[model samples]
Target: MRACHALLAATLAVAVLLVPVGAATTAGAPAVQQTPTPQVDDGAPPDRPVEVLTLADDDANRSATRETTLDVGPAVGAATDAAGHELRTIRALARVRGADDPDAALSREFDRIGARAAGLGRQQRSALQAFADGEADARTTLLVLARVDRAARALENRRERVVTTARGEGATVPSERSVALARELGVYTGPVRSQVAAALSGAEPPARVYVSTTPRGVTLAALTESGYVRETYRGDLRRVDDASLTRSAARDAVAAAYPSLWRVRSAVDVDPARVSTVRMTYDGGELAATVGSRNRRVFRDAHRQSLGVAGTDRQAVNTRDGFRLVVNRSYAGGPMRIQLRTVDGDPVAADLTIGPEGGESSPVGTTGPDGERWLLTPDERFTLVAIRGNTVVFITMDPLAAPRTERP
Candidate 1:
């Protein structure tokens, strides 16, 4: 009896030692404890709401403008206008057709333009840098910019002609990368061009230039010594109404292209055939500006316009941490402007890091008091990580992604 009792005591001690910590033994069976799974919140909405807003009839004609000041001269103005005209011509040529080995032809043209534009871009940057360093005057810098713009525009025009001709001959369409490169070559100088034109015509260019768009068209305006000098292009307004060439048809077309917008606002007059002289309010001016920019390339293939290369591209997203992030890229591989703000629209200063998705990240810079930073974008898709205190937000940045037509 003593021997048996000793053996039982030894077995019990071994059993207790074998059991895992926090595990329970019931009826001589060990019960394993399970760890609860962790939950992760990515901050994206379960169903992202489409972002589009349309204005009421009373506000449809209104314009929203952003103003800036820059020195201008006659020579610079003429050169700027000439560059703008060349870019416009390139856009037109993209609608035309071409013949024989168009792809090969396009590739050669692209190489030529690429080489020339790169040299000009470098020159422009050097001149601008000199001006920034106070080594060059504003007039001199503007002249250099104008010259570069003119040369770049001509190169782009030549490339577009090749693309158009090849496309007509049933050659493969140019890639988005090529189109983006071309667009970068002919940066939008609308505001500068207008001011320069005013100076060229022997008028004192306004100290403040306002760039705006309305249902009527894109307008560049300023309060000059003489009066308010305004230049408007009705092309976009007309294009918006060209879907079926009728008011109702145009409304339906706008609805189809921008369904989210159609759901909200009352239909406005879209009669392309008649002159609309009604003075409109600027209810959704930013939205109008976005749509106007898009309208310029409506006739082109949907793929090219997807990049939003025709104008400034803006996108906004809400962070999981109750912040709003806005990114603006005028063209692919161009300077990207990043803005961080609270949900209430107050700017937030935060450190920003960027890298390829699922890859190592590097710190770029922090936003300033204005909650904005500008950086050159890479040609590939990447991710932006914004950190403010314990709050961290991740946003995927696809430089080639289609831009949303919503106001940011």
Candidate 2:
């Protein structure tokens, strides 16, 4: 009977061990798994497997042999359950952070635009005041005003684009009040910019002319379309403000330097120690000359003329110092030709030398009746000196082909 009772007790323990730890008991409570103590052959306890409720790492939690249940309290001052209240708070904070991030970015962007607008406003005001004060000539003032107009237009366009993009992206941009004020400011500035453009239209002249004050005298230069200094005069300024005198000087210099630029406008740069000079540059050649005051003598033979005939690769001519000479290089390694003619197209027979200065003079060549003759040399950079009855002209030849004109 005792053996039968012992066998029945063993069966009951086996049934309890077979029950799942996650299962509910008859009292509707979770069954906790109790860890059994480990045994060792040497009579010492071994390390048992520990079941931990991990605060991090979902994989460990998913693989846990025992289940864990937590009952947290409600959020502070809230009536809802703790989990639900905490979840709602988390969602609300996430939304607030999301909105704040873009809002902060928008604020920074608009602030920069606002600063640019303020600076542009100051520039516009100063420009207007300068126009009223006649601080510079009409052309200079108009040029400055035109630049301001362009800058303002650019800013206005960018502001419009920013507002449109922000609206499209559902972003919180500048406030309605700020936008309205900006629009009002735009309205005020529009007419001002337009007025400036109109004033420029009436007051603007040809390419800018500059008169700069120097330590030695005064300088007058015409700004070319490509921003080059078309220096017209550099000489003593008996009267720094003498427009007539400067105009005359410019006329004389133009006549001597670029006869074709007769209608050129003038800008003055005044200096005392600066040397005054004039230059006319062509594609393959350049001519330069030193000049003095308005009373300075002009070169009588300073006529503009072509150097090479039609269809030549390189041609250059200088009609200054009472002479005319044109050198034409037909092709590389081909015989370079010298063509001398007067402004009237009469052939000028002259002896020509081609080489570097102070170097051995190349074989002399004389022009034919047609003012064309070949010099035996490679197409390269070398000085050409032509002499005829006590008259000498020196010209440097560049092999590259570029067509340009400068005058006496």
Candidate 3:
């Protein structure tokens, strides 16, 4: 009997020891945990709603302006008015194109005027250089310089009018100034015009980028819905709108923000949406997502995955007008905290998910009264996708690098 009792006691001890080891081993496995909601006093003020500024009107105005100025619509009809000014050298140069050429007369005139303009440009350069170098006195050389300047201005005006005419008539000119200069240098050729035309036609319009300098860094806003979030990276923030110019500016802004940390691998224009979808990859796998948008935003992840995920399969419906979701994924790899609030700091309720980076996420059971959730993940590294109404935020967390903070 004493032997049997001793053996039973030994077995119990071994089981207890084995239990702890299994628990510890499974601690990092993906799981979901709910945080208890604190009792609210009836007298406490109701949570103030967050305000998302309306952007539709302003965006429409910008879109119209961009289309009219940048879109290659119908070929501009020939100028109704004749060339506004005549050059003294108009009769000097012979036509490069034969009479059989459709634009023989215009070509001849352009060459003559171009030659005079080039000579004037050379003279102007010399005069400007001499004055800059203190070789010519500001006062003593005033009269001689004035006459030369007047003649040059007259020639340039004539050249401008001719160039305008060429553009109106849908003719290819090297440039506002290049054609004239090239002709004077005897470098004008049929191919030059063709090349110039091709370039002008294919050239992308300037990107409209609005840069607001912040204390930490700069905010590159793209004026697109995707660029509505306010997050920090290398002290800089980013968001976007549409137009070829804005797209380029967004790309340039990201490159400038954290050149050592992130890079824009590609930016493709979505003509239908008039916005650009950009891919920003980082130097290290330390960050999961690096881009933020109006509906959804991703943070810099520890595991470098492309910014923004593919498809909307897991997207959360956002609240139309409420607090913007701010996520602190500073926890090295898995799990992060999410808070819904306005730029001014009002908290609101939201639904959220915590999961492994690029894997199925576990739902962080309903938010507490404080509009906060303790996003839990099984893996050390994870992503949190939060949704409140219509807004969504995807956050990548690195628990290893997460700031050490005491949990209350």
Candidate 4:
């Protein structure tokens, strides 16, 4: 009995990836998770009519919510108006893709301009030496210096334009067609465009990218029903309007390719007056679901798993939203917290640790979800296990991570 309780407690302690079945079990005692919910004083006073509960529409959203935002559409360049700007990026990409790269066009351009300036500096000394040795022409030396200076300045200006237009550092947003361009950009509208423009004007492209970022069925249910919660998060995939796109073979290929790394969990509930929900949960902790007209699914990258899983029957699920899976035990290798890559591929992982890290920046209160100003260690953890039924990815996390989260 003690062993079973210990295992269940351990199951809750780990942040996620699936745990093996026959997990610690007591012969007769009920699992803590299976225990019935205790009644709360949430019932209204007698004589008051019982009201229906609905997800808040920007008002009473009291879920413990966390969010991450990023934009990872295509990279920002290909300036239309600037004739020469696009040429540079295309050329740079060409250089990146080059085979022999003998001339090294991009680097050569940078070097060529630098070399001219260096040659000019050396010219005066070389000219003096030649003059001393009575082996050079003064007029030729002077002309060489003049030509180098003129050429160097021209190269510098060209380089500056390349930096500015490609990265939007000094250049404007090319506002001439902002309105029309916006529609094409879609959800990656204002901020993404602005960020892209800003990025192009800088030195390097963004360091990362987001493959997906959407919440799912389970996450919504957990958040809306969880006690006194507040959070902001982004999921791995977006639940698009079209089912075809969601359940396409191409997507399945992507999932099976990287079964352990990428997956989906989906579920449907038909209780409480014909309510149906599909939650696609990933080890990445992205949650997304579909209720009615709205299609919800977390977006994430193509962690294509090339190898195939050898098994008699693997779970596969498809419904209104669409999803599939390849099974694998997530935490077999080691213990590491799961994090979803934002559109920019930044770490937008859910903070499951109840340590100082999660507390320091939490908006819940002055200290943290706990009364203590800080959590010295992780009181909880979760591990990724598997994505089931096309849309349900089962996970295990220590409910202790945010102990007293309700207080905040």
Candidate 5:
């Protein structure tokens, strides 16, 4: 009986091991295998993957990777983590060499700072991604982005000084790869910072953000409920203020830029909190204008003329002296091409100026053997005077007047 009890006890222990903890068995029912549910950290949702876009170093060379989607967080994290490792390695190298090696020390220092800046850039991109994904709020994201911008700008200035010192000492300058890596960080951060600033200033946050990298820098298009808002950042970390022109000031600037246009009307409702794109109505059509912050006095028109004959327009004037002047006007205040030819269509080289005879005039330059000269058109009403060795011909150009077609 004691032997039997020992065997029974052994069997019970085996049963206990087979059954899972916290599992209950019902009498007269077959045992069921219970698979344990996997536990998630902090009970948070699973990771949502996002596609991050990167621009190639050469803008003209297009590659499949240009459109390839990547998980931004992991990609950026890996890059920054690698930079950090590089920094540590650089520091170790610096420590090995004695203090007497100033050149080596300076080179290592330059590399270290570049790595640090790249790490900060990684943080900035992560913050922007979080804000875009609704994982973080605007205020927190903006603060982080602004801090990174300021830090990066300071580092840029510091790097310039280091370059100067390295040149003076005849030491090695920072490697081009390292410099490019640091600048690449700015390319990603600058545009996002601008978007965040716009959002903080009461512009609606974009529903979806699309990024494209270019040779110059980066362009970001934010899709909102209203429409797509596009902005380009060339990696210049300077602070940009919102458009500050009053209605009257904006109108005056446009008028001055297109003085030849009669009844030039300003239709732009200036927004103090955002960059305003100035739109003006003229007698015949409407055009867009961009005002510069440094010189609010000047306005640049946004219209462009096509070079192809399908949509190109031209104005022709005939002189009694058997000369024909063809004006290919560009957008107002843009490059206007003047072609001078004889009545028989022979190209003629002639000197051209802005004003009519005996008026305040400026030289527009001489035409080439092909009888074509491109120059900037004045904003006001002006006469294009062409002189070819005492054979003088002039025509008044008014942008407000519609172009008159000449029969060939």
Candidate 6:
């Protein structure tokens, strides 16, 4: 019986030793294994192992041993249970220490996230503040500019209205408006410009085309205070307002006739001064004097007999103080005497010729055989000229091609 009891005891111990520690029973309930958590600490947590602590004595008799058998926990469980109060104390300590291990780390992560969020918020706030400041500055600048603009507009509105009148736009002198401006600016002029301006002021706003002529050329003035209408020119020979028109006519007429001619320097009209004296005389009591411009020419003819053949004894004559005389005769060659005379009857004889199919002669005096004397040259082509009633003659020619006749 003792031997059987011992064997049975040994078997029971072996069975107990085979039980798992993780499934140790407490109050008849299985121990539950929870998922492990990593505990952050200075040292690693202690690991518990499943253990077998067995006393299998085959020689021991149950009756002699006074067997009071208790079904303890598994081997590692029993050892842990034997130290249960201490294990409880250790677990409580571990629980308390676990806070120290991971608490700082959790705090650090949270603090990191909070700091990042705070920095982002500060950046956003700064951007918004800068935008608001820029808007304020722009509004202030716009207000100042608006005030300046209003002031400028007010000044423009306060500016005075100006009314002025002027007569001659084409005149050399200043217009009425111009005069006012000049006076305002403190300027002065001589008698001519002042007189002209004053005279113009009395007239209508648009000036009339007044004509005046002198020995040199004609003048045509175009005047206006009004903006509209083309200017007019006063002219008999040609339009004088345009210097080009005058020049064209002059170049066409005078340049071909006189080699000594040159273009006038100024386009403005001017008059030529009179020559001192011009006299034509002959051996007899006959004289013709012309005092004026150089364009005057004189022609003379002296014939002893009236008729010899159809045309005979004709001479072409020229006077020194500018005169051209021609003798037209039917005869091809003829003997003739020609002379230029002073008012006191002194003769300057000239070259004589005759080939009269009626050619042209220059502007001057001419006498026909009928004793008819023409002092002034005809403006058109001439057929005949002759000395008339024995009154001497003086011709004054002006540069504007005007003829002034006087009897001597």
Provide the clashing-pair count of each candidate structure: 8, 28, 46, 64, 0, 22
- lDDT per prediction? 0.43, 0.36, 0.31, 0.25, 0.42, 0.22
Structural similarity to truth (TM-score) of each candidate: 0.32, 0.23, 0.20, 0.17, 0.29, 0.14
**Model 4 stretches with alpha carbons more than 4 Å out:** 1-24, 27-30, 33-178, 186-408
The alpha-carbon root-mean-square deviation between model 3 and the true structure, to one decimal in Å, is 25.1
- lDDT over C-alpha atoms for residue 201 of model 4: 37
> What TM-score number comes out for model 5?
0.29
**What lDDT, from 0 to 1, does candidate 2 have?**
0.36
Which stretches of model 6 miss by more than 4 angstroms? 1-375, 388-408
Model 1 residue 209 lDDT score = 38
> Candidate 4's C-alpha lDDT?
0.25
Give the poorly placed runs of model 3, Cα more than 4 Å off: 1-104, 132-135, 140-149, 163-408
Q: Give candidate 4's root-mean-square deviation (CA, Å).
A: 25.5
* lDDT of the structure predicted as candidate 6: 0.22
For model 1, the superposed segments whose C-alpha errors exceed 4 Å read 1-100, 186-188, 201-408
Error of 2 at 75 (Å): 68
Candidate 5 lowest-lDDT run of ten? 7-16
Provide the lowest-lDDT 10-residue window in model 4.
217-226
Q: In model 5, where do residues sit more than 4 Å from their true spots?
A: 1-312, 356-358, 400-408
lDDT of 3 at 210: 20
Global Cα RMSD, each model: 22.3, 44.3, 25.1, 25.5, 34.1, 70.4
Model 3 misses residue 171 by how many Å? Answer: 6.0
By descending lDDT, how would the candidates be arranged? 1, 5, 2, 3, 4, 6
Task: Estimate, for each residue in 243-305, the C-alpha lDDT of model 1 and write its tens digit.
Answer: 223344334444555445445544343323222111111223212211222242211101111
- Reference-based lDDT, residue 257, model 5: 50
